[model samples]
Target chain A: MKTLIIIRERDYVWLRTVFPDIHPLLFPICNKPFIEFLIDFSILSGSEAVRIVSDGSLIDVEEYCDNGSLWGTAISYSSIMSMDDQRAVIEKNRRFCSEEKILIISGLVFIQYDKLHDYKSLFASQPNGDLLVCNGGSLSLTGNPPKLQKNSAPLSLSLIALDSLDGYYRLCMEILGFASSPYVLPGYNNEAYCHIGRNVVISKSAEIRKPVMIGNNVQILEDSIIGPGSVIGSNVIIDRKSTVTESIVLANTYIGEQLEVQNKIAAGNMLIEPEGGICITMDDPHLLTGIKKSGSVRSLLRFLVHSFAALLLITLQLIPFLILSPILTIQGKWKKSKNIYYTGTAGETLTLTTTTIERRGFISSLAAALSLDRFTLLFSVLRGRLAVIGSSLELASDSNTTLHEVESWYHAGVFSYAEAEEWPVSGGDKAIVERYFSVHGNPFLDITMTIKAFFNRIHETNTP
Target chain B: MIFHVDGSTGKKLGIAALNGRLDAKNSSELLTSFERWQQQTNLIILDCSKLDLIDSSGLGAVVSCLRKAIEKNGDLKLANLSPKVAMVFELTKAKKLFSIFTDTGSALQSF
Candidate 1:
């Protein structure tokens, strides 16, 4: 059987106010995207193929789910108009729904189903029409219904409309209160009502009362209390003396020292009271704040370290650069170009003379091996404008000046983390590598990466 | 901010109605005004029914006011806290520092 999941934008309008960045379909319910649960149900109902139809932009959902090979199901995506009804959806996907019984799950609804039950047979036996529905959405079947054996037990199915924050919070808490066995919740569960992910660091003085679910890379500080009922997402830090009970702390949030977080949903710096549907974006860092990558002290220390390293490199390479550049330029082996590249800050650009050395003779090869091509950019490190090891230099132009890309800590550098890691120095994966190191790497680690990058550049046959 | 005396409590109860946003920009102003209000009456109730938003600095100022009230052998209670402002207090654990009431009458009576 095949499944078509139609999620209209209007259905999940309320969720946008709470989680603006996330698509409603991709909104996580217990660290798993809502669409994943629907996909799991579709697959369990014996669906060989699944297509997610949406009126809103499905770029994020498409990037995440992508053909659904990870779940062992062929997943596809299609666009629909906001006015498209159930009939229009089926009419549009006529080719897909032609040869088999098509299960049409529409709206922003949560289907409650037990994995232990034989839902495949139950769905096959049930007649086509609206099986279950709530205020926000419905679960209906279209096309043909498979024949079933006589005297089969009725399929037990229920739906919850996720229209408000209260509904969303209740759904999560309800799922968490019970054991996560009914749904495929993320993380490992050794015992009942407790699921934990990897790299969780709990302080010796901290206390954890069970009936809780914690995701990866979590740090519970000294005297902190977690649980009784809590769903802490990945990369969260509950600071010293903080107590988290009956709360859902989302990913990349830092609960400050001596804070009481009870019955709340905290995403980044935004603290939300699910019951009252009140959300406040905190302004103070000490109380509740987002765990961002950049820090003032860290940036200052990085600049000092990079400047010292650049000074040393300049001293060592000064004589070689002086001797080689004159000879190479005289011989037409060294090409120089004046170009303007983007600096670390927005609306800022740096004018620099870039050199491309032709590795033809022994002297030119020595120049290339010594990385004299990037010698001029080392001055940028001393000026505190660039890092010794960071992201590749992006030219200052309309195409390259993407505000989102430039806003990150991926500052222009003479030596890049991608070069050190031997990843592609350009394109999407390179941005990921650079961003990862920019967030995780310290000044001391950057020194090591710089050395690795310098050595890696020595072996390169082409110009950077 | 508007201050008025509550005669129903049969005590020198001061009810201060706070409206609009309380942030770093106006938190110090509130703190300065709170000192003058403290001189009128030791017992006070901060009615936050019209308060739409609050940040950490505003929370700090309120905590400071509570501290001053305690120093003067009196009390500072919160009343009619809007959900949004109440969320800030709860998140910062400032709600535990004061006697919070659902309405100004209750807070004045508690004096």
Candidate 2:
């Protein structure tokens, strides 16, 4: 049998109001995407193929579900009008539903089923008219009802209305409490109830209770207690002596020391009462707060170290610069320009007199080989303006100024961090590498990386 | 949250109905009043049916209450767990430590 699941945008409008950034299709119910539950139910119902009909964009859903090969079913998608009724939806999808018996599931409802039941046979044997349905949506036959040799035992389907935050929380908790074993949930299910993710650091003094789902990069500090139904998202920090129970903490949240977080949703300084749909954005970091990555000290240290390294380079290249300066000044193969560029942290703009070695002839080649073109900028590092190794400085303009204002993880450097790693200084992967080292690296390591960047720059052929 | 003392089975059991959330803000309140609640009886039944959410701190307070009750040769059992709240207990494996029941009457009788 084939399945056609129809969900209108109006059915899930509550999700957009509550979580503005989250795509409705990606809304997790009990750690599983809302769409995945429908898919699971369809597959269990012995669907040979499944098509999801939605009036809204399915980019996020499509990105996550991706052909549904993992579930051993061919999944497809269709679009319908937001005002389309059940009959209109079926009629629209008539081409797909023409050949076989189609199981039409509608609405934003959850279908609860026993994992032990063989739903394949149950769905196969049932007479096709409204086999199982709830108040939210229905299951009925589109094409001619199939003739079965034997009648199947009927299974019930209830509408789990997930229209409110309270419902969402309750639904998640309900599933976590009982459906843990039966459902394939995200995270690592090592022990019975605890499902942990990668790079979780639990201090020895920290106590963890079971039936918890902890996401990646979680740090449970000393004397803290966790779980008995806690869902901690990625990049969460539960500070010392604090406890978390029966709550869903969204990603990048820091729980303060000795605080309590029971039965609430904490998302980046916003405390949400899911049931009542009330949200309070915290102003204080100690209460509940977003993760602020301040690389000021590290950036300062990198600047100091880079400057010292630059001084050494300047010393080595001084003779070469002296030799090339007069000749290049005569040749015009050397060019100079003055522009204000961003300096790390202080947000101070420095007017840098940039000298470019033109890739014209043998004279320019000799000057480039000696690395003499970088002589002027080395003084700016001496003045503690830029890091010797970091990201290439982008001037602050209205178009790209939003980057700095939005906390760009990239640090402006005399020598790009990507150059040190020999990575192309663009693309998402390069950003990840630069950010990884920028947050974790120290001054000594910076010096070594700067040296590598210098040699890399030497190997790089200078182009326009 | 609601609290009442019951002695129907000849055992003094304090039943506390947790409502909404039992997180950091009010977990200490629960912990602080636990002694006073324990003074009435050692046996306790925490009805979490109305508790919509909990966090690590709230879980700690509950565990701490259990420890305090056990110290006095008393037992604390939970009843009517909301799926969400019960999930925390099961995830932390704290469910193993308590003698949980479906309702307050069963917990009271068990005590």
lDDT of each: 0.86, 0.76
In the order shown, the candidates' DockQ scores are: 0.59, 0.03
Candidate 1 — which pairs collide? none
DockQ of 2: 0.03
What lDDT score goes with residue A266 in model 1? 89
Q: Count the backbone clashes (under 3 Å) in each candidate.
A: 0, 34
Q: Which ten residues in a row have the lowest lDDT in candidate 1 chain B?
A: B83-92
Writing each residue's lDDT as its tens digit, candidate 2 over A85-204 gives 877887888888887878888877777766566877766666767655666566665565546635546565556666678887887787777667656677888677778888999999
- Using TM-score, give the best candidate's number: 1
List runs of model 1 lying over 4 Å from the truth. Answer: A149-152, A293-464, B1-10
Model 1: CAPRI class: medium
Cα-based lDDT at residue A178, candidate 1: 79
What lDDT score goes with residue A372 in model 1?
Answer: 93
